[model samples]
Target: MAKTYHHPKHDIHEDAGSMRADTKSRTTKFTSRHMAVYQAAAAFAKPPSRAWRLVWSAVLSIVTIASATVAFADALAVPEYVGSARCADCHKDAYETWNKSHHALAWTAPTAGHVLGDFNQSSFTHKGVTTRFFREGEEFIIETDGPDRELTKYPVAGVAGVAPLQQYLLETEPGRLQSFDVVWDVEERRWYHLYPEQELRGGDAFHWTGPYKNWNGRCAECHATGFEKNYSPVNRTYASSQAEIGVGCESCHGPGEAHIAWADPALSYDAEDWRGLSSVGLTMDFGKNTEADIQQCATCHARREPFLDGNPLPGAPFHDSYRLSTLRPGMYHADGQILEEVYVYGSFLQSKMYAEGVGCINCHEAHSADLKADGNGVCTQCHSSAGNPEFPSLRLAEYDSPAHHFHPAGSSGAQCKSCHMIERTYMGIDGRRDHSFRVPRPDLSVSLRTPNACSDCHSDRSPAWAADAVAQWYPDGRHTQFHFAQVLSPARLNPDNARDDLVDLAIYDGLPGIVRASAIDLLSEIGDPEIAERTSALLTDPDPLVRAAAVRLQRGAQGSVAIQNLLPLLDDPSQSVRIAAAREFLNIRAVRLPSSVSQKLDRARNEWQQSLVAKSDFPEAHIVIAGIALATRQFEAAVAAFEEVVTLDPQHIDAWTMIARIHAALGNRETAIRVLDDAIKANPQDISLSLLRTDMLP
Candidate 1:
């Protein structure tokens, strides 16, 4: 990615522009080279650590297992940010509109203007702990339970978001900032716990002071501009930095320094007749760029794990920087509806609008971040009596009329959002609308037990009542096509018998790449070599997600079997896919890939290692790092990495148990007992920790 951002507000137009060149082909040509698969097979002759052995068995359950940065590291110059202040000089109105938005206030140093919470010694209690909020001179103070469960006063160092709820951040430890759980309700003008239902306290991973709530690791990337998580693995501290306090002009519009340089009257010239400065000196041309605006927004909006540790280059392709979460069983309904706070990108992927090349800016105003129009007017902008020219495939009809929606005008049921974009509340008070734009499927809700808009509004009515009412309204299952949910639900529930069906779904062309990739990921649990062999064809798939998913399933096979199937993928064009194949290949000590494929493996393996190094702050990242160390017989390094995992997350049962196991294997019985005793103290309820110590005794 170029150092500059490039979404020019005046330049972007909603048209049928060409998509990214990379998306054009699913396959990249790698020369067909027959290489002998032989290297130091003894490299992994030693049995893997207990945690390492779980790679094939339990990697899918770990969110960050397949995380990788784009292979194109340092390939492009990172643009210099001249700040949003420079942008405001050229475009005052746009800057003003953006400044007033939630994006601009996404993250900020505590100030009277930015701080919305009551600081006049306001108090709120949850789970028998009372937290008092007050001001101490210029600093905001949070008097609450600390990490050690002792009453401590933490000075608020930062603030996140400005409306509905505001979260304050405190530098609880040296170089470590954590978002406080006690949030202030902007409307109600009182304090309330975001996780009011949960009995979270000190030491719980989800607690405000725990790793999950770390501001630098979890929140800063999206909340701030040009953020970098400079986490030092050696000292285990953060030196995190950001260009601006909040999501600003440079975030979407690239860097302003180059754009200002391009504005030079002496340098500005047209290149149509071979004149100078044809490129306009921007990171990318937004005039014909359809996906940049949307994909750029997805950099922050999506529920995804980074390919890199923190933020990858903002203007690059979405897959190059991040691996999007699919419609996983817990995160989404079987029918690809939003079930969790997955943000927008994953839900939008399932929409017909996205398939039809609809951009986020189409419905949303670019600067203000408001809908293009209020309520039904926003939907009418495209779904009017005359359909939008950009999408001729869309039906030309009165979609907002009672004749279509089967509800009276000015009613909640009549609203477009109520049906297609049914909302679910998250963070207790934050209600987010769905982005899938799906037609209400009360019928699926009846069978799959998925929530439908009708049943959501009519609380007293069951899905059967909603389905029956739908039958009366439009008899022939109006606009109801065969949904993938019927197949996916069964596949998720019982994978043993659903292998063939899942294999079919993985290759289903009509469905989105995300859905197909999800089907392929599920094949890992089937434990059938035949099923694994079936998904091998998808290794050459155009969709990187599908190909990566296919590569992951090959982990069950060993030696040349895994090698022959995975060698070419090490040179795959997609960074995420290449890294996935490389990670699996690196783990297979059964056979050594010959020097012929070493170059490809080296490049891919380096990229994979870089991802691990980048996300060293995350406990899951350490799991893979530690596994690799154990595989290579670096016992001390393995111990260090496993220790890092528990240090970040004390309740990690696998890491704690593995630590004791490795120590015992090395004949350090006394050292191992001390470790087990500590583990038992941290996780008293987990019997596995206690059993490890009991089994070790003579």
Candidate 2:
């Protein structure tokens, strides 16, 4: 019989700092790749030390570099820091400020020092069910659902900071994973689960051990340092690993090896050293030289997907590996004012600050997670009382007072962020605000029936009432007239009725590019020839995002004429648009292009070739382009593409399967069999690959 361990469900009070110190110091040695599986467990089980421990460890290791080098070589090991201690050494002011910021304590151990909630025996009710929070000895625990219908007790490993809702953590199995459940009333000193009533009453959608519970799949990458979620979906088990527990020094600074090398005074630092070590030493500068790096941070913080891994480096091309949120039905209102949890990255992308090359670091200090200057001071960096000639309305004295805001001077309502950057809560207690920096569009709220800032505070009032109030206060308010009224009008009726409006909106340059791109989607309901032709033109739009959107709309069109019109976009300058265009034109036969159009396509393809010349090291790009070639029946090109994919990402199962298929199609039976055999060697558990190999043996 398997030994089952039961955890007590109650609050555990202890010294969190000591606990974290122990966890960080305790290191485990393993003999195989399977050793990676126990890394998270080892990290979590030890106690944490002060930030100085990590700094001293790094310093000591550096001092005895020759001896440490032999030890590291023998173990194939890397050093782990508690957090950004080495960075703090150089950046004292920033480090001191960061110690007070939320990011430093984003995740902490459960103790009187870190745990801010009332954990004494208290019961709370929600949705007709009651749950209790109590202390059991020195450990925190929760009584919740097990695998079946049983109510079981589990240990609460951590607390999610001080807020209206504090969350508790539970370790499900040793060397496996930890889970989180909601806790309410951090300040009130009362404990209640986030959805205690619903969960206890059997109506909760997010239960323990659900799809969302597996932290490796859902949240580990973002929360922990150097996390590699080795989840085997078939086994339904996680073998996750990380360099360190919690977000540590290496999380943002790539790997520390090169930085360590450059930091040595004996070594002669060069240009490469400067480029690589730039992320170290700290300042408020985020070092987002390329659009991709800026957007890479945004992808995790923003709502996006991982299209491919290790292809485009962080800050290369966002769309190459991720698909950004567009104006979708549930995610946004028809006017795109962010109805759902779109996250800050996408919303910020649409802001004037982003357009002006003002990145996350311009306002936020990276290590400290605090503003570089106070609210008014930061705003005044660009906007002054003397007035910016480019932006005349940005006068500080005029815009700073209650006369312009129509609120009390020191009131919460008067803060620029409170009114413009309305907060949305995620994971029970984390309140994230939109960074779009848009004005209050009460008129749009009335038209689309979406929530506005005025009505959020004044819940009983209508949007029209709020609009009228704003109009009265600022007699010349621009938001009084809705810019997206026409788009919302047709969206209100039916998708079919708004087909023409949608098609027209796609190409309308006057509107925000995102808004127009969203409008093009409304045409999906209509099965007309004209709508297809209109969407085809968007394939050449100046914005790569718009062009990509057009390619998607065109693919759905299914008409031969539409396919022909989209073929030219296959060689688009933007890799995102080109990838989409290539995928769209896959099934269509090549049509004769006009000499001028052919020349344009050739030029675009040349641009794409130049871009790829340097990025040839990446396999996913080859795989994607190869898939396009395969779809177009260019078998040789497909084979070459698949070969590159397999070479770069040896773990890629799809590339191996395609290689087998391409070989079998060419009547190279032995080679096809060998290809599948190699795939099985890489991933022996892949039943599909095994079956395909067996079926191929003639």
lDDT of all predictions? 0.71, 0.54
Q: Backbone clashes in each candidate structure, one number apiece? A: 8, 22
Q: Note each model's CA RMSD in angstroms.
A: 8.9, 15.4
TM-score of each: 0.85, 0.64
lDDT of 1 by residue, 221-268 (tens): 888777778776545688887788788887776655556666767655
Per-residue lDDT of model 2, residues 525-610, tens digit only: 45566677666777778877787777656545555666566766755555556644534443444676686665544433322332
lDDT of 2: 0.54
How far residue 258's Cα lies from its native spot in candidate 1, in Å, is 1.3
Model 2 off-target regions past 4 Å?
1-83, 109-113, 117-139, 157-165, 173-178, 196-205, 267-293, 308-316, 372-381, 387-397, 424-431, 480-482, 509-511, 525-529, 540-544, 556-698
In angstroms, give how far residue 266 of model 2 lies from its true place: 3.1
Q: Among all windows of ten consecutive residues in candidate 2, which has the lowest summed lDDT? A: 14-23
- Scored against the true structure, residue 395 in model 1 reaches a CA lDDT of 83
**TM-score of candidate 2 to 2 decimals:** 0.64
After superposition, the stretches of candidate 1 with alpha carbons farther than 4 Å from their true spots are: 1-77, 266-278, 478-480, 556-562, 587-596, 630-636, 663-672, 691-697
